[model samples]
Target: MNRSAEMADLSGTIEVARVVLVIGLVFLHYFAYPNSRVPPFEGFDPNHHQVATFVNSFVLFFFFSAVPLLSTISGWLFFGFSARPWEAIRRRIGKRGWSLFVPLVIWNLGALAIAFALRAVAPTSSLLGPFGIDFAHFGLWDGVDAVLGLTRLPVAFQFWFVRDLFVTVLASPLLWLMLRHAPLLAAAALCVAWLADFTFFGLFIRTDVLFFFYLGALARLRGVEPRVGWNTTKLLLLVYVVLMALRALAPLAFDPSQPDQREMLDLFTRLARPLGVVACWGLCLRLAATAWGEVIGRYGGFAFFLHAAHFPLIIFVKFVLWRLVPAETDAWMIAHYAAS
Candidate 1:
């Protein structure tokens, strides 16, 4: 293929992968928010519940790659292809300010308003109570606290991703410099930094974002591509399966509540997440020219729109489902997933 064709193919592959990753993220949220009555096997026997949790958590591990993959793709496309890094940064800031930052602020305020209204109208309703705020008890300080993410209550639960992405973009110039000067050394340093106990500016900077972004930049600088064949893809799959099985299943069989085991599992998952990103990318590349790829690429932009709007939609759907069902039944779960 010609250079332009090759680049388009790669872009299509990444877009398809992104669509899949976002769908996985939706599933992760569906299972994570038990209060939303969306978890498929929630409220079962203790053993059954643990098993279900394990399975859900395992699925989540595969999709944890979603954010990293996004950062990597962004870095690759933004810094990798840029002729002038500083000019690119200025353009990125303007674009992202309008696209990401404005939406974030607007959505969070909207979510807060919705929650406040729900709390006011349905103070005693179970369906609305979880999402509602205690307006009667809510002080100005409480409002500020929620805005700052200091409490369990969030203005918008998924805004963290936007916040982190904003931070990463703001730092991209420095990152691009590092990647350009010494790609391998930069990647190695990032990986080590990812494994370390650290925070930036008193907030926990997502090291995975930095790591994967630099990884992508380094890949572009080094002219790397997803060149895995079936055999290599199978090997990656096997490794992922084994590690996830140990991470997920072992906890169910043992005392998952133990601090040490939980810590160990967290560490294991951190190591496995990047491998999962690579495996998923390889799979996407392998299928990028297939009929399915066209469909995925067609909806890739919609995935971002969905991510932005889905949380409020979920809450609204839950309210509607509660009114229709009036009971916590399997139908609620079915309807919730369908809406999601």
Candidate 2:
């Protein structure tokens, strides 16, 4: 294919990937944990509620790659098929300011407003009560922090992805240089930091994300387009299933330190992330090739909105669900997942 055709094809793949990734976000924020409640996340026994237990396991195990894959996609798009290095990076940064930063600020303020309102209306509101925030005593500084992610994660925590992406864009020059010259040395250093989940300047910048972004840059540097064809799909499916099974079944037999017969099902979580990225990307590529590709890519216009807004929407959805059901039953949990 010619350069223009290739770029167009990759763009469609990325749009499809963004849509799929946002759907994963729903599975993420809206997850109905086995014993999750005020503090969220607790016991796990597939026996207790087979569907709820394993479905959540699917969310936990498979969806962990959403962010890493997203970072890779973002970095790839930034450098895709560009010959003018400085000009391309500058243009990418400028466009990101509009596409990412603008929406980030708007959504951050919107979330902060909703959280503050919920807190003020009812100090013990489900919104902030469980987090032990005496929203009744929330101050101007707290408001500032919530909006800007100063002291902690921003009120719209998911937007941290956007924030981090923007940061990476600003630093892409350095990352590109590192990836181009001393590729092995740079990747090794990033590997240590990624494994540790290092945060930069207390900004909630995940190094794993940076490392994945680096991988994407490396792909561009090597003129490699990440594609999984029909030939590889079967093997990918086999490995994905095995990982899924390991995630779901391994926890049932082993006991965690909780001592309540609760098994930590995420033993293979970190191990499966890279695979998850590959699988999800493969799905994106395959989906982007079909007749439905253009249809879904059209909704890419609202993908950012859906992603940022869903965090608060899920909160509202859960509150209404709690009011309707007992919140403990397997039926209730399934419904919660469905509504979310």
Point to the candidate with the largest lDDT: 2
lDDT (CA) for every model shown? 0.67, 0.72
**What would the TM-scores of all predictions be?**
0.82, 0.87
RMSD vs true structure, all candidates: 4.0, 3.4
Give lDDT tens digits, candidate 1, residues 105-208.
77777778877666678766554544435666888877764553444434676666776666677777787778768767877877887776344543433567
Alpha carbon deviation, residue 303, candidate 1 (Å)? 1.0
Clashing pairs in model 2, backbone N/Cα/C closer than 3 A:
none
**Pairs that clash in candidate 1:** none
Error of model 2, residue 231, in angstroms: 3.1
